[model samples]
Target: MKKIMFTGGGSAGHVTANLALIPYFRQENWSIHYIGSVSGIERKLIEELPDVRYWPISTGKLRRYLDWNNVKDPFKVVGGLLQAYRIIRKEKPNVVFSKGGFVSVPVVIGAWLNRVPVLIHESDMTPGLANRIALPFASGICTTFPETTKSTTPGKSRYIGPVIRDELLQGKAERGRELCGFRRDKPVLLIMGGSLGARRINEAIRKQLSPLTSRFQIVHLCGKGGVETKLESNNYRQFEYVNDELPHLLASADMVISRAGSNSIFEFLALRKPMLLIPLTKGQSRGDQILNAESFRKLGYAEVLPEEQLTPDSLLERTMDLYGNRERYKETMKAFDPGNGIKQIRDWITTIMK
Candidate 1:
């Protein structure tokens, strides 16, 4: 049987792109295997899939800052590479497709050692530290942004666009309204803080919830451990996380307040949702999100409210502004092509195998 292995994980964003591509591989009857850390979110998401085998490997953080762990992480990476090499040797997959993360570096190197072709996907405007280190070993790197290609060796990177989960596009607005138990009198504003939740966003939204509630019905996906059950209102619904209903919630939303992650931004583009993006500032991240938000703003796909400028008043003002300018964004998003790369990615995998 035809076979392929996939590896990536640190956040849900890393694993989700791989999840979007899995159904096509199954339809073609390719055997699938995945390598990830045992405790990572990827292991939690991948282990239960029916046909795909999940293998756990040890991995270390690729921190950009110096810490005491920095002294010891190199040894952990070496150990992970050894474990990945053994796993690849036994599985003997025809090719390896990597969604970039620290866990993926070992897997990419191990696949190269086995003489298996490797393809990598990068979701930021510029490659992350993990992808940068894995670049030389990759056969071809697929990117969500064309600007990312300039940072890599010519011809090594291709703009394949973003991989969006099929379920997201199939959301039903009626179902979302029913689940949230709200009438359609006011427009819905969905606030997403990613998997780990954004403490600052959660606090700011709540501080201004009274005014926001007057203007719009609010649906908040506040991430795990970030919920306020005490304060309830007819116009507001709070969820720790929504799995099956996320699509419905998204479909019902007229506007979104979210972190500027590329996967989420591209999905919003496909859904034609007007958005006010709040990016993690350079202090908190390597500034990829700052770049992602800027690109979206530049293309008129969304509006940006930098993290430092994020006060309760500013958040509400920007959201209102985005909603007021909603039609322009909708028209622009229609023209914006965040290409669906599933077919192209699978085609690359097939061609490399042959």
Candidate 2:
């Protein structure tokens, strides 16, 4: 039987694409193995699949800032490299697929050392530190944004657009409304602050909840530990995080307020949901979210609100603006073609294996 090794982790964004692709390989009778950090979210997500064997390895955070962990992280990465190399050697996989997170770097290098072809999927407009390091070793790079191709090695990069989970497209709006106990009298507004939650966005949204909820039924994904138990309202509901119910919530949403993560924004684009994008500032990241948000803005699918300018009043104004002009955004999004990313990437893997 053919075997494939997969690696990526740290955030849900890194592993979600892999999740979208896993079912296909399983149906084709391929042996699937996953390598990820022992304690990362990827382990939990991947382990839930019965057929895929999950391997835990040492992994270090790849930070752009100076820190004492910088001194110790190299050792962990080296250990991960050695572990990954041994695993690849023993498994003798036909290929390795990476989703581009810090944990993926060692696995890509290990695949190269093992003489196995590796394919990488980069979700950001620009390659992150891990993908940048793995690019040289990868046989091919798949990008979500057409603009990303300019930053990658020529001929190696292909723009496949976004890989969306099939389940997300099958959500029922009525089910979502029932779950939130919301009536159809008002349009539903969904606010997401990314996986870890955005404190400022949370504060701003809560501060204006009374006014906002008056106009729109609200579903707030508050991220981990971000939910406020003291707050209560008939038209407003909050979740710390969602797994299976996300699609339903998304289906019921008439508009979205979210952080500009590429995977997420692309999903919104695919769903034709108008958005208000609040990207993470450069201080919080490498400014990739800023680029992602701007790309959407230029395409007329969303409105951008820089974090520095974010306030309760500003949030309310921008959200109202998004709702007012939502039809235009939806029309623009309808013109977008996300392509068949899952099929294209699967074809690439099949070709490389042959």
Candidate 3:
């Protein structure tokens, strides 16, 4: 049988594309393996798949700010590098595919050291730190944004657009309504702060819940530990995180308020849901989300509210504006061409393997 190895982790954004692609490899009867940090979310997600083998290795966080851990992290990355090298040599996969993240850096280098071809996927408008370091070692790079090619090696980059999970397109609005105990009289507004949740976003949403719910039924996906049990209303629902039910929830939403992670914004785009984007501040992130939000806004797909200026009042105003202009946003989104990302990347992998 053919074989393939995948690596990426730290956040859901990093691993979700890999999740979307894994089943295709399975159908082709490839022996699939995943390498990620031992305690990262990737381990839990990949382990849930029965056929794919998971391998854990030491990994250090690639942080932009100074922390005590920064002093010790280089050692961890070196340790991960050695472990990944051994795994790549033994497994001898046809090629390694990476969705860029801190954990992926070592695996990419390991594959290069083992004389194996590696392909990388960069989900942001500009490459993240991990992907920047891995660029020279990769045989090819797949980008979700057309503009990202300018930042990559001249001949190695291909713009494949965003890869969306097929199941997301198969959701039923009525089923979502039933799951959320929502009535159809009001349009549903979905609020997502990302996998870890956005504290400021959550707090602002809660403070304006009464006004928000008066106009639209609300589904709030609070990150883990972000939910408030004492706060409940007939028109409002809160979830810490969702998996199987996400498709339905998304299907029911007429609009979305979310952080501007590239993977998530693209999913929202694919669903044609008008959005109000609140990107993470430069202090909090490397400013990728800010760029992601601006691109969407420029394309008329969403409105942006910078995190620095975020307040309950501003959020309410922006959301109301998004609702008022929903049709226009949807029309622009309809004109967008979300290329066949999965097919293109799969074809690339097959060609490289040969």
CA lDDT, every model vs. true structure: 0.91, 0.94, 0.94
* Model 1 quality (TM-score): 0.97
Model 1 CA lDDT for position 172: 97
Tens-place lDDT per residue, model 3, 1-354, is 899999999999999999999999999999999999999988988999979999999999999887999999999999999999999999999999999899999999999999899999999999999999999999999999999999899999999999999888899999998988999888999999999999999999989988998899999999999889888678988999888799999999999999999989999999999999999989989999999999998988999999889999999999999899999999999999888999999999989872
Candidate 3, residue 92: Cα displacement in angstroms equals 1.0
Which residues of candidate 3, in runs, are more than 4 Å off?
none
Better of 1 and 2 by TM-score: 2
Estimated TM-score for each candidate: 0.97, 0.98, 0.98
RMSD of 1: 1.2
Superposing every Cα of model 2 onto the true structure, what RMSD results?
1.0
lDDT of 2 by residue, 2-56 (tens): 9999999999999999999999999999999999999998998899887999999
lDDT of model 1 at position 271: 96
